[model samples]
Target: MSHTFDDQTHGADITRLFPEQATDTRSHPSRPKRGDLAASTADALAAAGAATLICTGHCKSEIQHVIDHISRKYKKVNMVFVTADTSSLASFHEAGRTIKKMGLQIDGFIGFPSVMAVPWEMTGDGHESHFQRNYLCYFLLVNILLDDMVHGSRVVLVTSCVRTEAPAPTWVDVRFSNGEDYHCLEGYSQSMLAMILFAKSLSKMCGDRSIAAFSANPGNTKTNVQTYISMDQMESWLERKRIEGEEIPVSLQQTPKSLAQGSATILRGLLDPDLQEESGAFLNHCQALKLPHLDFPAGEESAQALWRRSQEFLGAFL
Candidate 1:
């Protein structure tokens, strides 16, 4: 049977997990409504002198609303829609084709892959495996961005925080080619490392003209991310916590902030004037924040090795 975990439940659990860190105050100050991201994007484009935009994701209605909003607010800028399941490179290419059909010169491309995944074994090493998946998603996005940059197009990598210092239920066990299974811990670590390395590599490769690689970790926002965890799983997890006398309230379990709220930081990263100077840095809540300490560094050798291995594993798909 399909089970679901509501936002309220998950939010409460998250708050209880890190009572000190999870504040009741709304995480995003200028949180946009669902369709407002487009207006924000237009404003960002105006500020950056960008003439065109390309967006990728399944949030077509939300994204389209943003585009329509932009058209109404700033009719001068060009917008192109590319629908693709970003988890797969094939989807990305398909999205690219759709964008080409729109007949707009692509000035910038934004990638938001659906969900994060990483080898499960990496978690035992004290790594955030979810972040590892995130990092890989970003890496693939960057690969597309770099190609765009080579052809003279700017690109933005959009992401969010799936794991915090507090404990949460892990729903997936991602396996790597090395026959290693990584839980959530290692996945998060690997993902972040991949992002860092991707940024560093893009900066080095393109120098000043490198496509800017900005990372944004939106604070708590209500969304469907918790759907991956079932009520049964959440209850079981909560039961375990209750036995330990954890002071978690049921109200704290609400879904994260709305997609608009969660997208705020990412929108800011795209629009912030200061970001030009901080291209390779990760931003948290729309502010430049220090990179979290990663268990593994995605150094050049490591990335090259990963690319080679992944290519071999995927074979012709590579």
Candidate 2:
């Protein structure tokens, strides 16, 4: 969504309201540190003296910058970048084998690959583009790497407030009727909601192993996630959200976070010690906020149904 904000409330500096913990080479901070220092995948792995497998897309430049920062600061941390497009199922399978061959014990996995508001199409894997790319592929990858995730490890599935803004998924037809009834916003929202539910399922499935999984809403930042959103589509989505939230500029996006601010909520889910006991919690702006979908009985039923369906669909990969 909408990035519009009230000039009166936030003033000139939007970062003032959504303060970031540390700075990185990119406009956004790489990660929020556990202590006073800045946090990154490198920093976390270094602290634990463990190996981690990071899966990313579209932000490779930013990741390379983090790799550079790690070399200079945390010399002990070893970083490896693998190119795996989440849109393709075969790509994830190869990536999983690559990690396994490295014998890397995955200490933390932060999945940041997602697309929004794209026109409907089926992926080569014979699934809806949004479902396959945004949710299913990641679902398969996580299950594929489940063997490597050690005790007390963390998994962050980046989600969005759009999950709440758009029309909830019709469980009977989440993939949509061959794009006939598909609305870009609805499709994106459905995937995001599946992510939230999947995080909960992941936490429960890990059980005694203590692999914490959380779905984080990074607020709103101007990122490549909006690349597919055209000006006309943006206006229509904003108008719809405005009517729903009944607030100027719409509240779904929440005052437009900086790249750093958006990254902070994600880092919190990954490294924040305070959230250790809050596994499967949905982090909104770095806090555990109860969403309407999760708070109701029907929502829980939908989540269970989704998890079961996803497991069946991705059974071969798992």
Candidate 3:
């Protein structure tokens, strides 16, 4: 059977797990009822008579509400809410095993998991920074499910361009052993940067495998993904930036896209026949982010480094 975990049970810890959670856990101030990309994608899947696997993770109620709220408008897709947390590689393995037992077939896999911009938090399993948890755990699950996917499988990871806001990672301490030494986003930047390389490297590994890997930048959406940034924290950072004569981060300054617009970008990459031949493409707002200022993976070297570290963390699981 599929897993289901409710957010209500967490009570206090819900704030930590979902730092952006509003005063009312039942409904968020920023959460849009309709027109968000995520629900729209689910609706599209349901319309195509496809089944959906919603991994609610730590925010069960919110994700479940999205699935239910949208499934009602669509064809009522066969969705399974995965209550298990994808915070660790071991959990990824268990979820894979469970899916295998249920005889489920996955055609498209999308991950929108993320966390706060606070100081680096270590994982209990590998003692890796929490920043990597969002990407690494999903990477493990994809590896585990690779053999299960038929040809033409699509793996889309919702990453951020905010990574460019920070500098490159030091090879030795990429896990941020000296996290306190870096700015809040510095470590997060490293993690997000690793995701880009991971996407590029995954495409290389998929050569002749008929599988495609893509990284999606939903652009600025008023989602809880940034809820980790509290108002007080924002003020403090803004004051610091002013004193330092630095401009506020655009991501923090602007209004976010509607949920519909954000998810549309991912849908374009996943279902757009124009992208059928595309692999390892990084998308922003449903188009190839061609901004000259933004950097994609430079060479095979850094991609390899990320792939190596990922495999090292995952070990035989890959």
Candidate 4:
């Protein structure tokens, strides 16, 4: 664990780079009041309407870097970054509380807080397993703030195309803290499969609200998630890409994205007006792509199972 945290903020670390203004608190006439904004605000920006985009995750430097780049590029779009850890119930509650108190109209949300592993382990606070941090907490995040989002608000949950590449689970239980293993890649992939189920379920759940939920594959552009893989795996991937014309960022765990490039997929997820009709759709390379065959469950059956599973795990918060 090269980087981990309890509730404490780590300084000067790229992973802890959230803005000071995003601190979890209420009524700080100066603070929060809380939140994040997006790129779909041209009309909103012209009318001076504030569009909030809540981005929850730990990697501060990366988050800050993305926000700063977006701010500079879309000068008219008033983009605010509400950075918070979405790895646990407490942090989600703290973040949700502050954002609720602030009363900002959330137009979009991009959740990128996820992890992979060499083996099973507890997360930063030891409250949940790596699988929980990567997947379940995201479920909690949407349920926590779904009320704050108005009709037509968009949500893009960043996931890997690995969901399609790997096998689905034999079960749909949301808790991963039993301290178990079903093989590393399979376990990690199940959580991703859960992401697809959640999007499908939540979109159907909120059909009345008109809130759109989507899953996004950022096209293998890299960030810090690569470090979890051994160099052998990365190099093997690199070799495959070399034989073909394709070059991805997995060579010895090296990433191909610059700061601006890393932000592009998320920006597309949050800003693309064309995606409004693609609710419950999977966005591969930022376009509406067909979903892979879901082997476990299908239609409202899977969605209901997931909704029930989420309620069981996150019932306290909901």
Highest-lDDT candidate: 2
- Write model 2 residue lDDT over 1-318, tens digit each, in one string: 123322122111232232221111011122222221123333433334333324344345635656565556656545566656766787877777777787666656666535678888888877888787878877877888889777777788877774443333447787788888777876887888888888887877786898888887766566534545776776786676667673435334457655555656666666555577788878776677776656334366777788788878777777
**Tens-place lDDT digits, model 3, residues 138-202:** 77767776776656666777776542343334356665555555555555556666666666677
Can you rank all candidates by TM-score, best first? 2, 3, 4, 1
TM-scores, all candidates, are 0.54, 0.74, 0.73, 0.65
Indicate the residue-level lDDT of 173 in model 2.
82
Top candidate (TM-score)? 2
Which stretches in model 1 have alpha-carbon errors above 4 Å?
A: 1-50, 57-74, 97-107, 116-147, 150-154, 162-193, 224-261, 292-304, 310-318
Off by over 4 Å in 4: 1-83, 123-128, 163-177, 224-227, 231-262, 295-299
Greater-TM-score candidate between 2 and 4 = 2
Comparing 2 with 3 on lDDT, the higher-scoring candidate is 2
TM-score-wise, the better of 3 and 4 is 3
Q: Which window of 10 residues has the lowest lDDT sum in candidate 4?
A: 25-34
TM-score of 3: 0.73
Report the Cα lDDT for residue 189, model 1.
37
Model 4 TM:
0.65
lDDT (Cα, tens digit) per residue for candidate 1, span 86-179: 3445554455455445544333444442343323433332223353334443444445434334333334455444233223222232343333
Judged by whole-model lDDT over C-alpha atoms, candidate 1 comes out at 0.43
Please state the error at residue 204 of candidate 2 in Å: 1.6
Better of 1 and 3 by TM-score: 3
The residue ranges of model 3 lying beyond 4 angstroms of the native Cα positions read 1-40, 54-63, 70-72, 162-170, 224-227, 230-255, 290-297
